[model samples]
Target: MPKKTEYVLRLYVTGASPNSIKAINNIKSICEIYLAGKYALEIVDIYQEAEVAKKEQIIALPLLIKKFPLPEKRLIGDMSETEKVLKGLGLQS
Candidate 1:
């Protein structure tokens, strides 16, 4: 049997803004439902980690980056749309 794919996700947010909170909730829900135990999620607050944000070249708030499993993908917004987020994460065709 093939090993399950492990996803590495990084979410860059700006403080505790509503959009950032929403994004965090949405992504956490998505990962729980979809990726489950096969994913690693890191939430980074740009306000607290300015250097990390600058190094990542983050120009938008509530950004989700899928850094593993190849062909890195980025999505920006509150991540309320499940289908869109799934597609961006390569979980859907």
Candidate 2:
């Protein structure tokens, strides 16, 4: 079982593209609603910090990663699909 109200997330995005912006905003909104202050969000802009992205082995933009509470998970896209995003991070039933 996992501890309550603990989350560590990393979002990797490109420049200021629409999809990237949408991904950042959507993840922020979701995390605020669901994880709130218990969450630690790290936003990495690949265009500005490609080193970080390379270290993470990211090949694409707008990637959301849940990296705590045991096994990690990754989600790619603008994060418009709640179910997919939640399930990817083991947040849904």
Candidate 3:
């Protein structure tokens, strides 16, 4: 049988604003608790790398984009909605 692939998660944030901080922190906590050593995460600060944001077509701050494992997904805002994020990322039942 073929093997199942894991996820490559990338978070694009505008800056160190409160929303961005929350999103980063929440995602990191989730990844550590759930994803752990199986996933790779990159926090891209759009304020420092505006080109990255433009390339990703990010229209908002605190955007979390799941890049790998096929069928990419995006979550906006502070990532305060943990269950929703987990569900959308295929990390929850």
Candidate 4:
């Protein structure tokens, strides 16, 4: 049997702005529905952790990074578009 893929996600945001909140909610919903207990999600507020942003080279306000399962992927936006976000995260075609 094939091993189930585990997801390691990192979300970079700018404080509690609406866009950031939306991104968080959207990703959380996606994780719960799709990843369901097989994922690790870390939220980094660039406003608080400037160093992390610099290290990650985050150029967008709301950024999502899939760090595990090989071939790292990144998506930028509020994450409100479920289809696009899923596609970006390789959850959908």
Candidate 4 residue-wise lDDT, 32-78, digit = tens: 99898789899988888888877888898799999997799999999
lDDT of 1 at 59: 90
Rank order by lDDT, top first? 1, 4, 2, 3
Q: Give the candidate number with the greatest lDDT.
A: 1
Q: Mind giving the per-residue lDDT tens digits that candidate 2 earns over 1-93?
A: 554658889898887999999999999988888777788899987888868776888976699888896688888999999888878877786
Query: Deviation in angstroms for 72 in model 1?
Result: 0.7
Candidate 2 ranges with C-alpha deviation above 4 Å:
1-5
Per-residue lDDT value at 5 in model 1: 51
Which parts of model 3 have CA positions greater than 4 angstroms off? Answer: 1-5
1-93: candidate 3 lDDT, tens digit per residue: 543338788898867799989999999998888886778888988889878766889998788889987789988888888899898789886
TM-score of 3: 0.87
Q: Evaluate all candidate structures by whole-model CA lDDT and list the values in order.
A: 0.92, 0.85, 0.84, 0.90
TM-score of 4: 0.90
Find the 10 residues in a row with the least total lDDT in model 3: 1-10
Question: Each model's TM-score?
Answer: 0.91, 0.87, 0.87, 0.90
* Number of clashes recorded per candidate: 0, 0, 0, 0
Considering only N, C-alpha and C atoms within 3 Å, which residue pairs clash in candidate 4? none
Error of 4 at 1 (Å): 18
Query: What value does the lDDT take at residue 60 in candidate 4?
Result: 83
Model 1, runs deviating above 4 Å = 1-5
